[model samples]
Target: MALPSAPPRRRLRVAVVGAGVNGIAAAKAFRGAGHQVVCYEARAQLGGVWAPASHYPGLRLQAPRELYVFPDTGPLPPPEYDEEYPTAAKVYAYLKSYADKYGVTPCIQYNTRLVRAEPLYDRSDGGAATAASTAAAPGVAATVTVSALPTHAADGGKGLDGAAKGTAAAPAAGAAPAADAGVAAAVSSTGPAAAPVGWRLTLRTVPPELQQAEAGQCGGGGGGGGGGAAAAPAGPTLDKGGEGQDAGPREWAEEVDVLIIASGSFDDPKPPAYKGVQDFLAAGGEVLHTAHLRTALRRALAAAQTQKGQQQPRAGASGGAGDNGPCAIAAGASAPGPAVVTARFPAEPERGTEEGTEGGMEAGTDAGTEGGMEGAERDACRRFAQLLAGGRRVVVVGNGKSGDDVAAMLAASGAAASVTHLCRRNKWAVPRAFAGLVSLKWTLGTRAGVSLMRPLHPRPWPLGPLWEAARWPLLRLMEAGMRLQQGLAAAGAVPPHPLDVGLDASLHVEPPGYFAAVHGGRLQRRLGAVGALEAGAVVLGDGSRLEADLLILATGFRRSMPFLPPDLYGKIVRPDGTLDMYHAIYPHEIGGRSLFVLGWNPGLYGCLIADIAARWVLEMAEGRIRVSREQMRAYNERLYAWADAHFSPVAAADIRSGITVAYTWAHVDDMLHDMGASFARLTPWERLRLYCAPVAADLYTKVKATIPSERP
Candidate 1:
């Protein structure tokens, strides 16, 4: 595939506020367009969520491996992975390789954090500048504040030696590094004065003690890097000298022409704020998000080893080197893998035991009527098993891919005495391969399959007429096939909403052996919200309670750019809290001139989607794509209306943050059209294969080659 040639325009100083998949894509795109790019990553590594610190046991790609690769990079080698979905470690390695292959690694500033971004609108007319101001004078348009977090051993900060390779070293304490020399020289040579519409960014260096302390709360130890540090409070601190003393991390500032927020949606975990949470913590119960499971489990195992030493004072009592003890290693010595277990489906429930009208719980009294002594003994045994990594009662909240994976991991671990999964809604679980025969990538993942569903926008030509006639029948057929493959009815996991409606919300792949765990009674699947937390128990919305030694909330994340000023932030987020961006990349109000947001949209094939979005950003920056603010707003309004109408009410509330499932193909198609590139440009045979064969990242390389190399 031919790369887009450098445009015949003055170079841009592009600042990307992340080093994740989307961030790498943005940097590669801008740099390829002959722009100077710098990507800032909070962690020492560049994989974002796939970073070692963010991974938990049993973490694997929910999508097929082919669908997860960057468009420009192609697929993971089959001989290397030999799996439909690769594990987190494998993905991280792939990302690092991709970065190196594309020269994006050197452009990344490791251990740098975005604090705040204040727009510096051109006010040459002497008028006060505000976020709403639309002055187009070029140069510096915004001031972004970023903190350089101190690196620690636990943070894997040595991945790139604490800075971009071949870049200048960090400046002395309290000193601001000069602007990129290459960029400064280019600016001076191009014109009499630099453009006045660029951004001025402020930088700070965090105190090591304060940064390490924050890292500890967020699973700061080895392999469990500071994934939760973004949630930690950020600001200047007061000195011991006096109340007026301003003492904090070292601060400085810089400027840039374009600011792309590739920070992603999963920065902040959104655990439920149930009543009595503090009491539960005080009572010695552990509450963790799926992101921190590895750290929590390691702590439990270490504590168990300590207890064993105290109880049995003899050598090798804890476990002989070769002994397969209670904490015996599973698939890998470093991380737990899925355990194979026999499945025994429960007999049909009595007539009255079906899903209840209230909370989807079985219609019966709470299961707390067991003899008091027996219940107490059972609780004590479970608690002891928790320490030994054997018999803890685990409660996992949420039904997304993370929740399913975690629940399955615990159930199959042969560790938890019982695994209870609590969710507010049951979702259609799509299998990677339907009936162990047809890969979803060849069907629903292709453009032809997307044409079978209702579209947010009008389909073009032949597809529109075909869809109008066969949409319902095709969708129904696909749903039936999914139902049969998933064995939803047999597993007692039929979702309330139909598959079409569910697609608009979220699509979670059924984890291996997940349904078997449910059928065998090892995992209890219930539908209800967590009403509150009590001493060693979780109270359900139906007033029922379950004893739990560990609570894992896979309840998802809250997406926000807290660094943006309130007025600017409000322009991007809607009144009801959904994002209001045009094409989920350009802020509608700003029209994609000085700012772009990537990876904010919830969708499938994220790597491919982000790459397309990045290319689109490049097109906009080079003046190949243009739209007025009114046009952008109209487009966004239509998108919002489509979502409200098609998405499930519950899903609609947080529509922009969850995966859009099957519509992802449609989303990509829309962007392709906007960029004047399409599958229509392919040869007849290639186009046929594109619609019928399993699509991979490399398939789009040809399509992207048709994108004009320079603005006309």
Candidate 2:
């Protein structure tokens, strides 16, 4: 891969918001390009969503260790780290180590929040100075104002052992130390046409007491004298938040050449809005989104431990010493491994709200239900399993991976006496092991297999039955493989799965032990939508009701950043709420240079995707990459066309619902094309082996090696 030589440009002062995998990758890449890098993480820790606080007890990576890392960061997990799906704790440790190895930890400002980011212009050429003015012309620069609060108010203003604290002359809120001036000057000196000045971020640090005070003041309780010691200044105070005679939040400004928004999606949990959800919560029934399962479970376990101590406390279980699974010693929680549990990986299901008529599979047009969940269904299942034993009658909603997981867990644990699963539609299921030996993903999780499965021409019309008929041979082979692994026909779960009506019944990795348990009558699979929640029962739309003590949502998270201003958010996001970007990384218009969004890309191998995007971002900032406006427009059109062709009816109903990047190969190829490279970068033999062989994590190293090294 050869990028055009970037013109001579001064180094940049890059600011990355969030210390997640993407943010860390961006910081490393930018710093490697001789730019000054600073990362802002709202949490006290470096790992964004993977921080121990964000994950449940048994959470682990879906991808194996080989695929979990970037080639440049570090080697694959050693024997010391839990191999084969490392636990969330191990993952966080790995990330922290990676940041430390690259010296990104020192650059990260923990407990710093980005309150607002307004784009700034250089105006040395002084055409238009307004923030809204177009940057299509040259000499534009960006400055961000930010607020940095104490790591913890109770800690007496200490920040990460004073590493994150700056001198009193710096901004009132935590700002970059005095050494940042040279970097800031270099950032403003970027090429006007290529790397424009990015954003002026306004950050505010909110200590716990201050947060409560602000909440009270904003809520009209009216105790306005909430004064807290302000953080050191990075630059001049652009604006102050407190009213007269009472100090509020202090703000500081920062100038950077590039602003990368690596804010992850998991922060916002989207609970489904069922009609009787409020009433159920009010009646003392719990509705814990899968995100908060760890906290909830910990509290429950603590209560249980306390109760046991009051009685005659038996010896507590050892931390599963010598266990192969990744366990967080601090959390006192065990990770799910192959011990006592059948190994099963979660399949990616479609996304949307299920909206189907009374009868199932009507007219071949309505394949099943509407509504698809987000990625990370696997962890949600493990969290749900932790709660299974507490409930007498468990009702699992959304018959996707989560529903299957709950059903299988209930049967395997022998926890719930009656486990009823409300499945409105029949979805395709593939056994984890296809022939009881080979992994199912190995068979179809490749580009070759996906290419074969995809239709040659777009089937826009509702010709699902015809498409099924055409692909009957392959479908039959799939059915046979599934049946061989999990005797579906012998167990009376005939036909194996629903009709492949316009991809309505796409095959997914079946949770282990689901069909067998259902066949044994331990778990009942009911096909109908929930009408409402009566006193202690879930009423079905078909006039039947099942008594359920615990109702698990299994619904997905809402992947939106509400913190972004409405006008800026509206421009970046489409009318349908889906991101409108080229290659899911860069916007088509020039104005997007000031801001970049990462980790929002929908695809497998997210870490790898972020690495590639980080490479592109470095290239863009250094003026090494260029794509014509017309070409960008065409590329976006192609993406929209493919999405329209592939998305399920339910997914199609909402613009934001469908998967942006469908599979691994095509998405990677599209990125390569944007980077002025081709699959040709791989050798002829390696190209042939791409679909079957493990992804070459070192591919980025090869690509970067091929490009001429810059001034750095």
Candidate 3:
């Protein structure tokens, strides 16, 4: 008898929001699996964060580029671009190319915004089902609504309001308003009889043709569509006219089997609410969040470049006595001595801002008369060259990657008058490489390294003492190596080395210049908090003052899904401020499989993890990987319990950070086991040579091939 053929697999009509790395990858995954994928991006272009609008000029990858690309995708950078760590522009280009290679760009609708995705009840109209019988039955489907708006109105980076800004626009004749497009896909019994009820989507799109049509309707009043001749002449426009509501964009809706929230963090800019911040900005003291660096730094650098070009001597000025009498200023030399620092107190308490340290040396100290510039100092001076770029007095707040990166960039440029970093605590900074020789990937990114160094829970077994004893020799050796190679202690008085604190206080560092800069005094690392800002000055916690013209807040972002309804949001995001994801991807019990979130975790390899998540989601949709509600809840409880017991005090304050660090290995390892994939391909002898190697992205290729081409 002939072998039985597998049943036809179900294909979903998937809606993916955002054209970012995660979004693009998601679209590709769904489309490649024979599903219809529609990607909506609010911006006019792809490459969400990597796009020119979101990043600064000097931005580059913090980690190695080796694992940045998808494993199934071929060697990237195209050989034409040979840099290992490419600039922001190059990275953006790479993303664009990836979309093209995967054929995902075509399905993406640029300048489209997601308005809202509301669940549509099948049994009842609008309210929740209170009956136990009704609750046990298949739940209602959801509908997503989006409206089309002008690019200018949508790109303001405001919250959902910006997205829904033009939703009230009158529908034009013969045009398909976003509201009319709320068509759901037909369910087929052969493929997905058990598929979860779908979603209703509201979306908005701005087409050039529609803009011209609207302009013609208005008769030269522009695309505003207000009181002029452009007003719709007929009955039943997209919006049901109402008082107190402005004319919004045209909207439409669609029903999708899968709704992928690929709208990663970074859309909303969180501004610092320090006292005097508004006063300083109003007084012409420029203040910007790092999110605006791409625009802000680009303009500043272009102006400086132009001025430098104009000041350069013409080709004729390089010769003899006839060419020039005396050189006006030494080439490649800055003004003699350190920049001046002055203190100023506001005539009146400007919002009662606190005082801070004046950044220059003490009154009696002399320049170039301190300790010899060696080790940390040597590193600091090297970093100072980048910090002073553009001759701007900069004050960087927060000690995250963005803060450290910008500080180093300014110090190394040697164009800034002063660069001082205000930090809350002295967190451990792990160098990109251990001992300036071994890549951190080979040390911290490997299974052995993490397993050997992970903190043990005393509650479990007397394992805490055992872990401490086992790691003592390795910890001492590693500490000694770091001190000998980098001399981090001499750089500045950070807290006791993280190793001494059971690795609780450690912070990962990329590019490895921060420690050197801090210790060498090239970058002033102050042990205080920023109280407030005044004209030309910032007040520190210790009542000291620092003069800064440009204040850059490098505070990180918050994870939010404004599009999600309160009921759904409550289920996915917990009261503890942590996402209640089963594997940091799916909800424990979302009634049905209507929603899945990607790119929400803090992992060493974000791109890789997202790819893995895409695979897992697909498998779940195919009914191959089944996760019970009880099992997922138990897993999450254990994960959080461990975090509460072992993480540092600082980490405990934020549930996300604590769980992220503690479960990094378990997260990836468990996912691999679920997919039946190995982390590496090494000979028996080769595996013994190195302590351990980091998991390569390509290791999933074999497992991916095992996924049946037909269906589960």
Local error of candidate 3 at 627, Å?
A: 1.1
**Would you estimate the TM-scores of all the predictions?**
0.73, 0.69, 0.68
Report the number of the highest-lDDT candidate.
Answer: 1
Where's the lowest-lDDT run of ten residues in candidate 3?
Answer: 354-363
The 0-to-1 C-alpha lDDT of every candidate, in the order given, reads 0.54, 0.48, 0.48
Cand. 3 TM to true fold: 0.68
Kindly give the stretch of ten consecutive residues in candidate 2 with the minimal lDDT sum: 217-226
RMSD of each: 12.8, 12.5, 14.8
Which of the two candidates, 1 or 3, achieves a greater TM-score against the reference? 1
Query: Which rank order by lDDT, best down to worst?
Result: 1, 3, 2
lDDT of 2 by residue, 563-660 (tens): 34444566567776556565666654434345677766644455667788888888666655555445666766765665566555543322233233
Compared with the true structure, what per-residue lDDT tens digits does model 1 show for residues 1-712?
A: 1112333466666778777778888989898877877776665556666655443333456556666777766534533345655555567677778877778887776545555455544332332223321222233233322222111111211112233111234423642212222222222222212112345444333333344432323322111111322222221211223222124343334445578888766555556567876666566565665434433433343444456555422111133243322222222122111100000111111110100011110011111111111343233223323443355678989887667766765665556778899988778766667877877776666667666766767768897887788878877777888777767787667777766665643465666677777877878988889888888899998999988866877766555665665556676887667666767787655332567788676565667787898998888766566454456567666765776787676655545533345366667877777778857677887777777655566768889988765433
lDDT: which is higher, 1 or 3?
Answer: 1
Across 201-319, the per-residue lDDT of candidate 3 in tens digits comes to 55654332232232211101000111011112121122223321133335555555567877664444344567776566555455555543333333333334455545433211122
Residue 571 lDDT in candidate 1: 65
